[model samples]
Target: MSYRQKQLVMQYAEINNVLDFRLKPELKEALNNIHKQLRKLDDDRERIYLEYSQKLA
Candidate 1:
């Protein structure tokens, strides 16, 4: 869970503190951004590893 989720849960533990509808779009955007960043990182890591491996081969 994100920091926002933790804060919400701490403030409203009952009923699992359902998310407010208004934040849904923002949450989706944040998730999309994270996925894009992670994908880029993975691609870069793989490319760098291959580059080094080829050099040592």
Candidate 2:
């Protein structure tokens, strides 16, 4: 696999481990919310990058 793909896989594993750790319900909910927001931001970044790359081509 490509270096970028490997890095993303590792990052996802780390996030999963963090979510698995024992924590209160409120804190867990907050963390899950943050994760959701981060995923959305990543999606946005990928979309912008794709647009820029297409424009360059």
Candidate 3:
């Protein structure tokens, strides 16, 4: 990979790890709420991402 690509990949990984650690509890709570609200939904991953993205925006 190019240097810039490598740098961006590393930065993304670091940010993802930090966000994972810092927001894990809140993410879990959001997931639980989503599950409760939409019992028929089968995709937890997408649901969590959508919820978190909405919250971040």
TM-scores across all candidates?
0.59, 0.57, 0.31
Looking at model 3, how many pairs of residues clash? 0
Which parts of model 2 are misplaced by more than 4 Å?
1-23
Off by over 4 Å in 3: 19-57
Top-TM-score candidate index = 1
Q: Write the per-residue lDDT of candidate 1 for residues 1-57, one digit (tens) a residue.
A: 245445444543432344673655565555555556556666777899899999999
Please count the clashing residue pairs in each candidate, in the order shown.
Answer: 0, 0, 0
lDDT of 1 at 20: 74
Worst 10 residues of 2 by lDDT: 1-10
- Ranking by lDDT, best first? 2, 1, 3
Positional deviation of residue 53's Cα in model 2 after best superposition, in angstroms: 0.5
Error of 2 at 20 (Å): 13
| lDDT of model 3 at position 56 | 100
Predictions in order: lDDT: 0.59, 0.65, 0.55
